[model samples]
Target: MVNQAKAHIAIPMGDPAGIGPEITVKSLAKAEIYDVCKPVVVGHTEVMKKALAVTHTNLEINEISEPEEGKYEHGTIDMINLDNLNIDHLEWGVVQAQCGRAAFQYIKKSVELALEGKVAAIATTPINKESLKAGEVPYIGHTEMLEDLTNSRDPLTMFEVRNLRIFFLTRHVSLKDAISQMTKERVFEYIGRCEEALKRLGVENPLIAVAGLNPHSGENGLFGREEVDEIKPGIEMAVEKGYRAVGPVPADSVFYQALQGKYDAVLSLYHDQGHIAAKMTDFERTISITNGLPFLRTSVDHGTAFDIAGKNIASSVSMEECIKLAAKYAPNFRS
Candidate 1:
């Protein structure tokens, strides 16, 4: 049975050449998933049927043109078939331009549904970057694509695992460029944004701790001056503006402190800083949430596993977590 009060979560099938289809089928096969939300996969029905056969899961594929037509039952999987992939020519574990284009179309459709209020939220699978480039897609990854599609400016990314939340100050840039881009002004702007993002996630008063750029937070200018020169001043400015911001805490210990509940969230100085902490804490459950968008979007932190595509061995824990998180936070998301 399905919960009529539950929100509808639109799932975008990732790269067809990878384990996305496998994971999607596996995750939806679990009856517990229907308890929280009505999930509608936005992708090719043929691809999902292939996934069902490979995984040996017995679930009926109920194709529908819109989310409203979904059965939302435990024994059935509802899908909005885009019919973009040719399963005969599709090779698992290989990058194909056609697969890339198909993946983009699925995401585009899910985003459109979310924007139109047709779905409560979107829980996305992994898309291969190489395949996307081969297809000549304009965006690099999901975040960039969502930003462009929604016309959102500087959407904030927050990773949650086991009650610990981490916000990246910088992502997808070289360590050198990341360091160079860390300015007081940027920090100040991000702190306010981070605070707002937390509030949107239902945190009434978020105490955000900013991680340091150097060891021991520059050891008070011993290891480096980035803390004294920029980070600390930025925190001070944010504090003066009535934001509950703290740190230039030592990068080594701040994540642990946040995990221990000392802070509501940690503002990581760069990509790996936050990614390493969250993934190390719990790799499978480290779900990514994109804030500052018109609708809530959650995704599996893992990538499309090309080597194990169609192998029935890929774990769907991350995908399940992504959908659950989207459902958990959808009610609070602002339009």
Candidate 2:
């Protein structure tokens, strides 16, 4: 059980070239954010300063050498300056190996903090896959990188929202590649993770709906047999295991039902299948949770928004929501 003391959250600066710094600054400008919990940014202090100047947000930026020295004051942003990057060569709207490497450092430090119990949870901004690849991280995104760093092999993706928590059994793959990657064991493992995640989110008895891979849930195998051979069997096994699970439901309707509160969450077969639905339904207000991690991690559902990187026009709604969710779940992180 977590101590009821105020939890400190570490927000990793995503890609430096992206809008991560700007959004982080904007998110900290709100005074109420510090009221719930203490937030310490784990990234380059110069990059954050640049973001603050770009956004023209009048908030104060406090650079602390460690998370414990952070001042939990309103209108002030305290950061654990990794000092890993030189902001001189970063170019907006382009991917750079240096930025990627620096982003990875920020994440590594945040994970270290959680493991050491210096912070209660980790909240991250979105990082670019191309930047990460350029940096030679050897993984697609944060989830995979975290999995590798922690030596976890389970199939895990970002879970968004509570009422309609969504999971991607296959992410960052072509439609064809995704279909090839779908296996019964992988599907079952995702279901198991979803079940455990929901219970952690405070649902005593959660109901999960698994979406079909093909049109009309394979239209009874006319469209595809994955539903019968893979998805349905996984659902059945989950149900037999005493979890309230259902589906191989049509992908189109499963999300509709989820939005209407018919199910606690939906396990989607691929990336766009779940992400597109959730983001389309609620773009600004959605929350992204990285499940199967050793500690609770949540982040803004949107990306770095390079197009609007320095304009100060980026919205902080998602970041604010992420902060709130981190605080709400901070009590659940076992320390």
Candidate 3:
């Protein structure tokens, strides 16, 4: 019997020409997944069957039209089959327009279900950017697609690994542009938002550490003035607003300090600043959460490995971690 108390996590199989299907099947094959939540694959049945054959898994597929119809049990994986892909013509380990379109459709369906309250949360696989472009999809990646679909503006992103949390102030922009975007106003706004995101994740009165942009946090304006001019003022503003925010902490040491339990979360000034720290700590265990959304969403921090598709060699650790994190935080997630 499925545990009614467990949250239902919708898994959208990413690019069919990639390792999304393989890892989704491999991750769901674990018994531990059933112990925590009821997972339903929002993807094509044929693609999932091929993945099962490649991975040599004995799991059976239970196709359903809706989440409520799912058996939600172990040994039998429930899938909301979109039937969008023609598996005979689909080739793995390459970019295909058809695969890209199918991936987007899967995500759309999962988002629809989440909005309708049919599912508790979503744990997404990776989609390819080239395929998406080839397919003429309007969005470049999942974040953009989700934002447009949900009508959300500037969604917050947080990376979680081994109890360490890092929130990005800026992402998917050039380093020069990223630095240019750093200002006292921007930092102050993001700090408040990051604190609220932590509270949603069940952290009470979160202590947020702001990471410095330059070497030694500008050495007091010796290297750069971003720390002294913008970051510190932002932290002060956040603190004055009754938020427990601190530091334009030196980038070199802030991540390490946060990992050692010095703070509940670290506000990374740019993309790679926090990404490198979290990934280096544990690459496979790093799960990315999209905050400030209408529903909870988690994803594998890695990309779609087109080279290793259908090789049965892709590690499912990241997918497992994504699902586990969604289940762990779903209880406290609002809407």
Candidate 4:
């Protein structure tokens, strides 16, 4: 259990043009979120104000200069305004460099807070990749950015949800590129990370399922030998290390069994194989937790819905679920 007085959680308001600010306002308007932990948003207050007006949410913005000044009160949105970007120049539904810079600042501030022990955990909203690049912060996604910022050499893994965890052996790469990166050593690292993540999630004995790269798990090497050569050997190494792992399982059937609690987590050979299954199974409720970070980090599984920005139609379900999961896992790192 965490000491209520010292435990605070920081949420970065993602791309100002996106629905991040809007959903953040909605999440704070609820009374239940504050009951478990103190949630302080690390972004500009003006953007949140605009979001409230756009979404028609009845949330009062508490502009805090520091973490200690936060109200931590239910039905009130507290912010540690970084004051980096002016939202006036930001246009909803369009990518811009300024918005990207703002998003990056928010994440940076949250990371500092976590490292300083001002916050117990960090939960982020979706940031647009194009905007990030437009701002000159060249990162493909949050996982890569966080890894660079934290200087973590350990294998960075993304876990989709608690019961049905999945990791992308390769992210933001073409199918052809993914094939090249899927070496035996990298696959072994993924398996190791999966094993450690399951233990962190309180799984006493995790049954890891590995997915095949090609169709039908390579059809016994008829299609591709990745399953037979790289993936199978990785799983064998993990099992040798005392993990109850077995696979190179066909991608199609693996996720189905995982959802039914047959496996603790599935390590997909590539991005879509795991993501399609996770999102299809439960998109709204899915939470993405980044493993191998110094502190607990969780984010919304979905991306910035540029199409629905300022329309007051974006769903806050995923954001709220992400917050809950962050709070749920924060206590695990109290030491």
Candidate 5:
């Protein structure tokens, strides 16, 4: 009720062989979702039909050629059907190359709509990596594929769990390789980027906390030298440049402190460190927001649960959260 305008969010039906379709159906079933955004699924009609049958959701699918035709009303699911998926071959709880290809196609369509300004933002579902590999998709995951499609360079990944926000220095790289890439320059660069990203999300004069790479931040060089050699200087450099930055805060306590409102956000040095902290705090609510893209993009943090695809047990909390975030931040995307 605070804001009456509803942003249009594009939902891509990820690998039909997975839980994407089901979750999308379940999420769209919520009347609360229609309150803030007009969501149109960029997927196949047959796939969504099958999902509606499985989930027993009462909403009717209204396929539109574009977002402009959407009714954007409760009890009606407006979709941009690609008609790419053949429902006959889809087997839930399994990976299929066709499903992977279909999923990629859905994302491609979503990106196209985003680029054309047909939608305000995109709230994505889980796509199977094994399926992507089997389908011979060039990019490994959504982030990389999005980066390539938008021609955006190194899009920053930010996680929002409640009030706490986290940014990774590196993701999907080997632990050793990630460590090697951590230098004063890279850390400093990430700090500045994080500041810019926060501002885009409507935060002004944000405070950033950079996590240490070692135990107790190297205990003044006893535990590891990376903190002393690289991290400390990075914070100092950001501060010198007039950025509101702090820490080499210990990985063990930094996330907790940030969650407690001591800091606006934390800059995790590697993948697992931040992943563990975020997932531990709240797994289902930890949504990933890709900042620096041409348009706003949000995703469910979890992957496609192939093990429990069609039983209708997958929690739609994350999917709902993803769309909510897209609606919340869509106004900020320069794209």
Candidate 6:
């Protein structure tokens, strides 16, 4: 029976060629995971079995057609069996069209389950973009696929590690593009959204600190004018409108300050700015929570480590944290 108090989180095994299945198995091996939520793998049954052998894990795979059918207990992994992989042709760490297609199918099924409210949230594994291309899937990454699937416009990405939370202003773009996109209106817009996003995570009256574009927050226009010109003005607008926003705080210290509990979250100006901070603090525990979706979604910050695909040495700490974070926020975020 599905536990009424526990959220149902769907985990889409990443690229069949990568460590997604392996990590999924390793993460679920812990009994503590069952204590928090009911997690069901929304991927291939055969791939999971292969992962079992790779991890040398002893657990029963309970195939279920729906989330409610899951046992949601320790020593058992309940799965929604897609039965899609051709186990004979499966090779670890290689980009294959079949693996890409299977990966996409898993994500699609996961989205369906979440949209139907059968699952409270989704904790996704990594997917290979090269394999996705080879499979003729048009989407470049998880965010793009999720935005389209959920009919969500510009999904918000938040990185949470320990007590620190961060939101990106721009990602997957060159440094030049990121700078140009940081207009006052854009910054102001994101601050408001960031505040709302934090509120969804159950943060009360969040105080958001906007990271500076230049050193020392431009040092009163000495280092760079982005802070004086674009960033500060944007923050002022948000403050005027009753949002508890501040800075163009010096990038070097803003994150540290947030970690120290001075602010509820930091709005990072670019991808590397926030990623570096989160990963550097504790790489394996930095989980990416995708806000602004109909249902909550959390993912591991790392990618499909193709080189370590079948290697049992791959760590499952990030995967476990991803599922736990999804469970943690599911109650507050879900409809």
Highest lDDT: give the candidate number: 6
Q: What's the TM for model 5?
A: 0.97
Query: On a 0 to 100 scale, what is the lDDT of residue 24 in model 6?
Result: 96
Q: For each candidate, give its TM-score against the true structure.
A: 0.98, 0.92, 0.98, 0.93, 0.97, 0.98
Residue runs of model 1 more than 4 Å from their true location after superposition = 1-4
Tens digits of lDDT, candidate 5, 1-335 = 11236788999999898899999999999988998899999998988888999999988889899898889888999998888766788899888898889899999999998888888899999999999998999878999999999999999999999988999999999999999999999999999999999999999899999998887889999988998899899889999999999889999999999999999999999999999999999999999999988889999998899999998999999999999999988877733
For candidate 4, write residues 11-122 as lDDT tens digits.
Answer: 9999988989888887887787887778989988888888999988887788987777878888788888887776568788899999898899899888888877778899
lDDT of 1 at 1: 16
Off by over 4 Å in 6: 1-3
RMSD of 3: 1.6
Query: Which residue runs does candidate 3 get wrong by more than 4 Å?
Result: 1-3
- lDDT for 171 in candidate 1 is 92
Positional deviation of 126 in candidate 6, in angstroms? 0.6
Per-residue alpha-carbon lDDT of model 3 for 1-335, expressed as tens digits?
A: 12357888999999999999999999999999999998989999899999999999989999998887888778889999989877888999889999899999999999998888778789999999999999999999999999999999989999999979999999999999998888899999999999889988889999999998888889899999888888899889888999999888898999889999999999998999999999999999999999988889999999999888999999999999999999998887634
> Which pairs, if any, clash in model 1?
none
Give the Cα error of residue 10 in candidate 2, in Å.
Answer: 0.3
All-Cα superposition RMSD per candidate: 1.8, 2.2, 1.6, 2.1, 2.0, 1.2
lDDT of 1: 0.92
Q: Which stretches of candidate 2 lie over 4 Å from their true place?
A: 1-4
**How many residue pairs clash per model?**
0, 0, 0, 0, 0, 0
The digit string of per-residue lDDT tens for model 6 on 110-156 reads: 99988888989999999999999999998998999999999999999
